[model samples]
Target: MEDVKDYEIKALKKQIFISNLKAWIIGIILVAEIIFIGSFFSKMGTFGEESLSENKVAVVRYNQEVTEEFTTTIMERMDEIKEDETYKSVLFIMGSPGGSPTASEELSEYLKAFQKEMPITMYVDSIAASGGYYIASSIKPLIANKNAIVGSIGVIMPHYNFGQLAKTVGS
Candidate 1:
């Protein structure tokens, strides 16, 4: 009976040890993945301009569909940059299909005004079509990636006539 109990205790200890080892391995993998992803995004310019240092390039990452929200966020970022003497020029990292042509035009005007104070440049990494180009066009000497798409300068007004379909279906 004593020997059986010793064997059982040893098995339990081995199981617990195996469980802890597995957990540690998983944790290490998770940490490694996070580090790798962070490095990739860091090279891609990430999203925040707060990290820009004094006398360095101030980056405004706009990666959303152009809308009132985009306008508000970018305008606020511009205002913040205006006060900071830490940047010489503004680098806009734009990527979007864009929205609301009027808003884009308005934002373009605002960016133009801001450019009057400090030089503004745009770097379109991904899709910056439609209203996106509208805003980007306002920037003088716009810089873009070799494969970056810069087209579809137009507007979309989603209008549907489902009434005819409903009538035909006799709902």
Candidate 2:
């Protein structure tokens, strides 16, 4: 009876040790992942408060599709830039296929307001078409590379009659 109790105690102790080790490993991995992601986004010009306080040119990257959420984020960033006097100018780097027209208009208006306060240099490194170009055009000194596409600048509201097409196809 005494020997059996000792064996069970040893088994339980080993299981607890293994569980603790696994938890530590997972915690370390999670911390490492957070650090990696933080560094990655920081490189893409996601400025920290410390960086914003310094005397540096503010960079606003608009690479993703223009939506209301993204437009709001941009507006917030612009407001930050306006508040920070250390920022002498802004570099707006754009690469987008364009998105919501309303969002683009909102961004354009925000940019126009920001430009009035400080200089903004718009750089279209890659494709900036339609709504993207519309927003970019609002800012002065817009620059684009030779190979960079900067046109297809118009809005369209398509009204598709799918029911007629289905009837014609005898669906």
Candidate 3:
């Protein structure tokens, strides 16, 4: 009787151990899947921000501030388009207030060079004014929305002319 009781206890412990092992393996697999899926979505820009497409028509979104990252992304897209034989033409859908004059000039020159090789189109969605307009003008065909604010062909110095305000405060 004593031997039988001991054997039963041992068997229960073995089954419990096996069950716990399976649960641990399942937990690890779940964690790994979560990590893999999260990383994949994040890299593909499905979660935070939409990524610039390489093979298809590249969509470059510019807001108030355009950073080096944006410029780099544009350059990368241009390179990809140059390499890809599937795309016959490239288009710049502009929706920007404006940006760095240097970046704008660089982008304009790049587009002009690209247009030399293949057909390029510029379509302004909302307001492609100032530097934005500068870039758009380089392209062959420029199209703007009916109510879109366009054209600001000039340079702006970053100096505040507050002489009148100072005089008023003194008086």
Candidate 4:
């Protein structure tokens, strides 16, 4: 009976030890996760603050689609420009074939508003067609090379019909 009681006590001690170990491990993981997340957020905040502080000339290049994020970035940049007195003007170096109509319109309106506050100039390096031209035209003195493809002044919906090819393949 004495030996049995001792064994039972030993088992209970082992069980308690395992439980405490698990608790310790879980607590360590939780603390690590919190630290990692805190550091990540701190780095992101620093990056955002630095980007806002740096001198920036908004360049909408290539087939860069103008989405809400793009608009927000532009707005933020405009605010940054306004806040900095040393930054004289905003130059939009546009090099795009254009994107969503609504996005383009929003960007154009925002640029117009910025222009009202400060001098806004657009230098079209390459083809600023369709919606790209739309935004550029809104600017006061639109500068573009003579050979540059300037105006597609229209919208095009490109589609491909593979019906014939599919029929030939037995789909």
Candidate 5:
């Protein structure tokens, strides 16, 4: 009889140990998820005090190379501003040397669509060349400094034939 009682106790202890371990693992996972989500949201913004104001102005600064990441960040910011009714208009500040043609085209289209919802005014700080100028051209009422350089807009695709060089080198 004693042997049977000992066996039952051992089974219960094993079950309790497994349940406690699972609870600990689930708690750790929840904490990790919370940290990851918080960091993601924190890194995804350019707006500062203005975004929190009663009647905010979404200030988008295009002061970097217009890559896919840049375009994505701008699109996300625009979407966020659109959802928040507090944003009255957009102040698009520009200073770019231009970058990917595809990203530029994508951004231009998004800006045009965003314009239908809210007013977007552009201001050129220093320069806006190539894809940069291409994007700025979409927004209306653009204000630039008298000396600010704008519009050296064009796209170039260079093709190279290295086969001849490789053959000469006997590769």
Candidate 6:
């Protein structure tokens, strides 16, 4: 009888321990998921004080090389701000080595047109060369990081020699 009682108590304790372990593991996973989701949204400007407000400054981050995708995203954001009718100014956050003069010019034209009604600012951090600078030209309020490289304003006619690269890589 004494031995059986002891065995039952040990079994119960083992079960409790296993359950607690599982609960802790699940808790940790849930916390991890929450953190991941929060950071992801935060980076995408989906939360915080960055939300659009009437007459508030709108910011568009243009960090990649100037391309059609960059132009499209800028245009979309600009359109969003235009529809809102309250954002007083648009800030172009620029850091690009620049590419595609045609793309840059199209974006430049859009910014110039938008500026007729809403003010635009250019904040150049790190670098804004070539096409990047071209787009920033129309924005009246230009701010730059002291150490930023601001020029290389010109066109690049691309002609690639991919034969060597293709031979090196089995693509």
In terms of lDDT, which candidate is strongest? 5
After superposition, the stretches of candidate 1 with alpha carbons farther than 4 Å from their true spots are 1-53, 157-171
TM-score of each: 0.60, 0.62, 0.56, 0.53, 0.62, 0.61
For residue 54, model 5's alpha carbon misses the true position, in angstroms, by 2.8
Better of 2 and 5 by lDDT: 5
lDDT of 1 by residue, 16-118 (tens): 9999999999999999999998777765557444443456677798788889877888899899988878778899988878887777988899999999999
**In candidate 5, where is summed lDDT lowest over 10 consecutive residues?**
44-53
Q: Give candidate 4 misplaced runs (Cα > 4 Å).
A: 1-63, 157-171
| Candidate order (lDDT) | 5, 2, 6, 1, 3, 4
Give the root-mean-square deviation of each candidate in angstroms: 10.4, 10.2, 7.5, 12.1, 11.6, 11.2
Model 2 compared with the native: what TM-score? 0.62
Q: Which sequence of candidate numbers ranks them by TM-score, best first?
A: 5, 2, 6, 1, 3, 4
Alpha-carbon deviation at 155 in model 3, angstroms = 3.1
Residue-level lDDT tens digits of model 3 in 1-171: 999999999999999999999999999999999999987887676774433443445444554443456766887888887787656677778877677788888888888888888787788888888788877778879888999888876677799989999899985
Model 2: residue 123 alpha-carbon error in angstroms: 0.5
- Cα misplacement distance, residue 71 of candidate 5 (Å): 0.8
Candidate 3 root-mean-square deviation in Å: 7.5
lDDT per residue as tens, model 2, 53-122: 3567888999988888988998898889889887889999988889999999989998898788899999
- What's the true lDDT of residue 156 in model 1? 57
Model 6 stretches with alpha carbons more than 4 Å out: 1-53, 157-171
| Poorest 10 consecutive residues by lDDT, candidate 6 | 47-56
Candidate 4 global CA lDDT score: 0.75
lDDT of 4 by residue, 65-143 (tens): 4466666776787788777765667777777677678877988898888888878788888778877788788898889
